[model samples]
Target: MMLFEKKSPYKQLLNLFLLSSFVLRIVLLFHPITTTSFSWAEIIKIFLTGFLTDFFVFITASSLIWLYLLFLSESKYTKPWGYIIFGGFLSLLIYVACFNTILNEYGGVLPEIGIGFVALKTTFFGLMLFLPKYRKHIRIALFSIAIFIITLIIIQNSISEFFFWNEFGVRYNFIAVDYLVYTNEVIKNIMESYPIIPLFIGVGIITAFFTYKIVKKSMPFLEKLPSFQEKIKSTVGYIALFALATFLVPVLAKQETSTNVFTNELQANGLYRFFLAFRNSELDYNKFYKTLPDNEAFTLLNQQLEIESNATSTQIIKGRTTEIKKNVVLITIESLSADFMKMYGNELNVTPFLDSLATKSTVFSNLYAVGNRTIRGLEAVTLCLPPSPGESIVKRKDNKNKFSTGSVFKEKGYSVKYLYGGDAYFDNMEDFFGGNGYDIVDKKTFKPEEITFDNVWGVCDEDMAKKAIQTMNAEAKTGKPFFNHWMTVSNHRPFTYPAGKIDIPNDAKSREGGVKYTDYALKQFFKMAQKQAWYNHTVFVIIADHCASSAGKTELPMDKYRIPAMIFEPGKEASINPILMSQIDIMPTLLGRLGFNYKSKFYGQDVYHPSYKPRAFIATYQDLGFIRNNILTILSPKQKVKQFDLSLQPSKLPVAFQLYYDEKPKNTIDPTLVNQTIGFYQTTATLLKNKRYQKK
Candidate 1:
């Protein structure tokens, strides 16, 4: 009867924990917080796929606990201390489950079992507390691990919250992971945007209390250990089972289909996404995704672009400009959404100065940004290309000495400079600009005395404006036309500006206040520029790096991508153009306005050119969008293409749109629009993958 003494109490506890984890995961999956509804078959598929990922996590977490149980279970001190450790871990699991459930309720998604892996890491630290020999150091070690775990959870949750708010509950994909490489900048931005320390402290206290209560309750379950031979056999069996589970889980869990991006993302685990991001940061267009034959793609693209037969993939167009030597200032404002401006029908007057300036400037009301991130915006304007999948070229390793806007300016014999309020080193801006022949002028170039007000992001907008004036004034004295790309930072979160500069009080500290302050800074910058001799001769180009919000039901929301773009000339009459334009169009359009004749490789077209057709290119990290002729076409990986009709006021009435997949249904879809979308995206992707953005 004693031969197989009913499974050890420890093993019983392990089984209960694993079962509880599975049930908890299944419950969360059924109660998914998503805008889209799923069919029963889709739900079943999601559950089964999700279960495999959860099972793998469970096996990994339990195996470590099993190893500890098998080796240390026979020790005289193991039973009492092991029970305490297990209870503490169980409490952590409960806490994580509670946290995740709450997060889901708030329109967030996390891995069903990813928290177990996180909790398991914390549980190992509790092992030291179980050793009687280290009793003297137990309190300190336990406190340290508790604080560490709490801090990590708070930080990660904050990041998830931000991403969900801005990216529509998408998990940490390749783009998100790429952002992590800039740890210093990311942490500083987080600290500026949130009250991180206080929030973490509150969470820490609550978690600590639960952990303490569980440990106290488990102390009473102390019992004598089984034989050594029995322990060894259990350890061997557990290891073998764990090995088998690891090998089989991924195979059984088929990769989720991408019928719908939001649905696919809803079924994905956040932790698994992070791992996937790291593994597939860079995608080969011809391999992982759909692509047309190279020659056919080029033929279509050449026809759409209206290129000559002899033109290369990276063809250089000769610009036609009369005022090529005029001073140019390109001011890229941070988080300046078109929605915030009164010109865009906003009554808040968040950008009063900009609104007034729009009347005296040539404004493009229908301009859209290429991507959500600042780097993407920069790439669009500088490189003048549609966004490639994965990371922006600005952040990539090979981003140096390309045929950029700066290179074009340099060739025009103008002194080109990239002016940033913050460190230009962030996001590899310095590398990209420096390699492209632009002088870097940033926070480091400013004197301590010159900086009147500063925050984690950078010096205030007013200070940067003054610095720009000072720099440009010097350049003016040299009698050479100067090109300055000034990137402002005050519109960013934790927006702080000098007192009395704007109607909104500095202490108000809100996004609206930030927008107001940025408007005020622009007014001051213009005031200072007007006093200078070079002011009248300078043509100022003002545009937003990207919009403040990027979240929506559709991956590429038309309204969210809309941004204000203007060209201000002293004597020219102001006019508004409603033609569709993209961020990539900025450079070519500017060159055309300046009447500069030069050979250039740019994907953007001069909007004012006689043969130019109006269209805009917009994208998320993976979805390429082409908006033209009141129709929007989106191209995704896996040979997927989606088209939507926006002829019925898309921004005002999104629900009225008609959606089509693959081929357009009868006369419902425009065949020409479909061809243009496919040609542009496929050709651009092919060119980027083959390093053909520059002359070979």
Candidate 2:
């Protein structure tokens, strides 16, 4: 008759699991990964609605364990079921523990731990086998330990997810797995630079204690087994409940996809996101996702690319021919959004040097970056291709030896080098560039004495510029037209620069400060270069990797993707081009400027070419944006198309209702624009998925 008497242990365990899962979901709801801020009322609504999906997933995931327990309740092996459950739970705990620890240290999951993890699981089971007499006591101890471990892991994963989101602006995806290749370097950097180990351990212990106490209290039903008839009834009820929870609940409570990426991501659970990432890590545009007929898609793409009908998918486009082979220096500045520059109407004066240089250079007034991430920008400029779904080609398997920009330079007998202020291995930059025939010059190549300043990213921008000059000088000795790509990292978060270089002090770290420091470093680099012999022969091409702020109400905010691009050749007349261009166009455009004729598989056309059209391709991870003839079209999953009139002046605000698609604007939709949008995105997806970007 007591509250704790004659209760079922299985029911108690299920209650504990549900309670813990709900708590974890509630905590994550409060701490959203997106930059978009929500009001208290909005947050509550999202939490309440999102709970439906979360509960469905939790029940589905735990159903197997519940069914297993039910089966054991009807068998003579019921007592030993506790030991089996303990062993299975312990194995899962060990795997998650190792996976999370490795991810924290190395920024990825390590597959090499599988063998060792299996051995550890076997040892735990072996120990349980020898303790048959103490089975009851061991079960209680193991159950408590499992609950504590799971709680600690949840807290740890939540913290890690926050940091990951802060840097990349999305939940962890398959691209994160690429970091495992540099485990030693990542671990070393974490140990030497970050001092948060003690804090994590302290918080983990406190959380585990509280979680254990709650779990122990939840196990109030623990007395005895039911009679055969009672068990049969309970089993049938559970099976029916399981079927409803697993099948019907998911269908009824599925989360809806929204036009706002932030909202869609907010609705997602971390475990769900991780599972989705793993499931679609290698997507087939034709089979897994939406697509068009191959021939039709290719025909559309060929027309857009202005290729011959008989030409093969990978057929090279022979661009303008020239006798001169100029030394090219491509500078990709990090987080240098166009709006940050004075030329773009910003009054900050943060990039005075770049602003002044823009006036003297062949500046492109309307250039859009292909995607938000640095890797995406890199892929666009180097491969001159459209953004593919999932991860960038740079991080994908067998991504090397393609017809990249470096391959063009290498074929032309130029010394091609990919220069980075940070570890090129961080995002598979080293592998991609090296595999494409570019010699890698990164932080590892720098001497200790050569580094005047440094941060977690790598050597300061000034030091990197100095090293670049030294490398180019050596390359010049060989009398080869060298192509050097200097990817700057000073304009990144936790921005630090050498003292006394800029008006903004190192202690006053901010985005404005980072921009100013980056400008100062460039000014210094040009000053130092002016004295060098290669200054006059070399053509300096300055472009941004991507914009700093990619978040907006619109799916692909054109303003955010608009970046400054200028080709600076000494003693040449400066002219501004107002044509809309994409980042992928830069390579072919550069080649045309140098008058170099080469067989290229690039989808980007030279802006100066007679056949060139003023258009841009922009995208989020999942949504594709195409702009042409003053119209903007967005192609999203499920074959949804949204179009808008983007003829409004860049300096002016869009009419309130004209920003996105809504019920009121549905009548004004243009079928032509919609078709054009679908054509471009579908074709691009087909090309990328089929690896048609490269010629056979």
Candidate 3:
């Protein structure tokens, strides 16, 4: 096709940009795994709204080339300095297109190599700027290189988006942002999950084809350049349109055409959604969500507190006794949801060890994770707080010296520790957990001989388990009660572990394999623990950080947040507690059973307390959900509050329930329930903002 006139090379490039986006976005929309059946009207609306969203992103993205071309006269374009500087950037892209992918696939990537390359390329390119004789030849060479690099990036992003959608069922969100922060793990994960090299080289022939077409179309540009005045006249619309798109962001966001969330998500542009997610990554609760006056909120929350140390005066208290206190070992497993267990309807037997262990443990049947991410889980179980909107408290600035579950243990004379199998610095865990007064044990603490199996996420679960046993044994020798909080990391993407350890083959490289292998490791740990002197004295608590997948037809599928929670001790009661509780409640409930009594500032309540209320907190980056009386109330940004019917039954082992929007919010919203929800979150935001939750 004749994309543009011979005189307008910029127009040809611009046309290709929009056309490719349309093709790629539509391909994602029609992807077999992600898409659900929709009406023809919904399809057209998705296309129309998505096009508008893409146009906004294009205006902003094209500003890169737009600004480059605006002042780029023949004199500037012909300069040796310009070609060499631009070529330096193209070199970086080439490094990423080839070398970066390979390094991630094998094992790990070295940032120091990239830094040294940058320094070397700068010196080499600087010398070229002095040699004016090579300007024309270098400029032509760079043009071809630029075309090739751009096409490679386009193809790479398409493959990544399709795979990301297949996993998460939406465009780029906060989770993708987190992946960007930890590129080494994310890259290795993508490489392990997919055949990146074969796919890239095989599918990359299209890159060469497009580069040739784009090069041929731009050949006329070398002969003669447009005059500055003509360029200004031709590109005036670009500036106007860019400003208009920027202004329309908030206005266009309110235009929701479909009731089905999946359709609305499909209608959105990936880059635009990413920009929105980034912009609101750390939202201030009082500013974004519905709230009440601090005094009134605190009073309402205090009224709802249960009797005997469950009050919220100055701090929160779950129980009032330290008589049953013993050495504690809390294991927070990664992405291990209730559905993965055989008792919760998983016939695959991925969690056979946990299933068998549950028979003699205090298994909570309806425990809901407060949020989707591991950081959120850590925040809830540690601080025992409702997720404080936006970033978890574990990652936020000024999260130190707080009233955490660890603080309670320390106050009760137990030596406390925070343990992880991965680098604690990944999610700011090192700072958060360390600042709050706990002996830290992460991948950095592992010695050369200590490592038996390792991957992008650091040591495997078995090694970490062995390390935990060692740490506990050391504490036992000290003759002080120990409270160890250990986080596992084997059940994640690109899930590889020590070979021949489980019934599932290691070559599967699947989530099932990951779960089963982690289960095997847990079993091994217990068998060895039985031989230890402190085995009977220590109370073993097992739970998941969060569910594996949080994607569903509705925003927060009630089932996706349900995880297995069990407390197994040698002579402890093994009854199944059928109460609806949140991840935040796990620690407090355990403490209650242990008879822990300390001044506290946590939102978690002891389910065993006589006056304890049955509620669960669930949330995403944007929406804050409070569930009570089978109704779900979500408080969102712009002071938006909505309610839906959850119809959750405590008797059900795992609640596979969806949010029914068809039900009237008025019917679901009890005035007292709404007020309680608002008061709980509003008071939390107030307390955290003022740093009032600090340890005395």
Candidate 4:
């Protein structure tokens, strides 16, 4: 065996291909893993995205590398670096088209400049590689031009979106430019930011260099080139490896997707249609509780959306109700539920202060929390739509769309103020609230002495409530009715209450103890509220943002969505309304009692309205249930519809049940009612697809 066995050209090609791929992978491996740690699933996704992106990259790079190396090689007019270069270029173009095709399917339009930058990066890799002379300069210049055009397109298209986000803090799903914004800021916000992006880019550059050297050292001269059959044999391993990568990428992405508590494909797309249904139709975000579909599901769902739109239009035209009204205070209690509170018939007297308040106020016994998260609760109580499933409105494309509440109230001159004990930026709620025209006060706004936080989430509930009271008192001095929203935070995870205030049993979990402390905070808040001048004139609307569960029993079924909602008129008497309702219904109900004639874009009906029947819309992370007049229908992909009879003292469920069985909406299988219910859910899905809310 000589130094080069038969010096086959085919061997040279195989070596070059492998070298290119290895270089790309090594570079990627050295690149700091994105600061956003890759779960095994994300790692697989990286392989997939990288596989496609690098295919073209390798082609262009290898060709450029071979050309430069041939010139440098001095001996390789024999190397036939041209053949490897040609193969790489062809493969890369195919890869770009495939990636862009997927993007185009979702209506993406990449700027010409962005395309140019991609070409440049490919050229830069090739130039660093050893290559031949005749084709080297032309290829380099062409690659550079392509890179320049793509970068220009990217920069041009991104500038507007960049300003939109930086100046206004607007974020959207799939905007691509937002990634650039975050990347740029990764170095700026030292504490509240991510780190992996730059590391990967740096490592990638280094790996490319080593790969080219490997290719240059290993190539054979043209006189020793192999036959076509040998070339095919040599390429089989590379082909099989590439094919395997192609099939694995999406599978890994989907596997990663399953880890999320909620599942909604619409989140993968934008929630544009749902927002449109919100702005243009009558569906409320909080009041609606179910997964919103993006495309086909949305079209089918929106068939009867016009009916709701007409209702909304009717309310808008009729305008604000002229009535002797009280000021409004909307309190979003953190992680509260009827099951956890003593007043809602729970066994433990966990909420004694709230219990006492319930007796004096209009207590809604069957109010349900829609989504499982706090942001979902925010959207529900404020925007009145079903939860956006896996995606949050604060981070989605619909964030810029003006929801009707703040706009409607502001139009009426009701000064709006929002107070939360945490970072409004956490759920992107601060930007969202400000977009809707509410003045926000969060942890960043608090004075040093006034700030006492249990953790990074926000300030304590006591301080937040106190500040809200002070703000309300100041507003009262102006004699203008106001809209105040207070979102509490102490009852959240890693719960910590004020020191030495109350002694929870040692056996109880820290969360349960936190709940006990929040109850005390509520008592203190009300004590302060009573002293405020606006107390008598304000109609207090209180509802939980979510529920609290200890380690043992806090898990959810459909019933976990059941939480407490109460309306209190200070000088008024207590009353019980046993009708089942949900968070989506809160806004409409409050507006109704205030004698506001406007109809709401809510799936929930007013519990206080005599003509309104009780229908509970319940949601778990992956399941949805409809409970009306004691009959519950749980819907899931695994099992479609499950019926339960809550009319039985303790709700009874069938062990093995079928969804579309003999069970009907009214228990009589009334086709008309079934059509109405089906129509409603379908219409909701359509609204999400259209993003109807953005229109308004």
TM-score (all chains, Cα) for each model? 0.78, 0.79, 0.88, 0.56
TM-score leaderboard ranking: 3, 2, 1, 4
Model 4 vs. true fold: TM = 0.56
Candidates 2 and 4 compared: the better one by TM-score is 2
lDDT of 3: 0.78
Model 2: how far residue 203 lies from native, Å = 4.3
Lowest lDDT block of 10, candidate 4: 261-270
Q: Candidate 1 on 159-221: residue-level lDDT in tens?
A: 453344344346566656765787777667667766789866865665465444433433332
In TM-score terms, which candidate is top? 3
Cα lDDT of model 4 by residue, 86-171, tens digit: 44754665566556644455564553444554565456445534454434555445433433333333232233323222221221
The 0-to-1 C-alpha lDDT of every candidate, in the order given, reads: 0.71, 0.71, 0.78, 0.53
Taking the tens digit of each residue's C-alpha lDDT, what string does model 2 give over 302-414?
76676645223354555576546889999999988888887667888999999999878998878899988889999888988778766778888768777788888888899
Off by over 4 Å in 2: 1-45, 61-141, 160-206, 219-257, 288-292, 311-322, 452-455, 496-500, 503-509, 647-669, 685-692
Query: What is the model-wide C-alpha lDDT for candidate 4?
Result: 0.53
Worst 10 residues of 3 by lDDT: 655-664
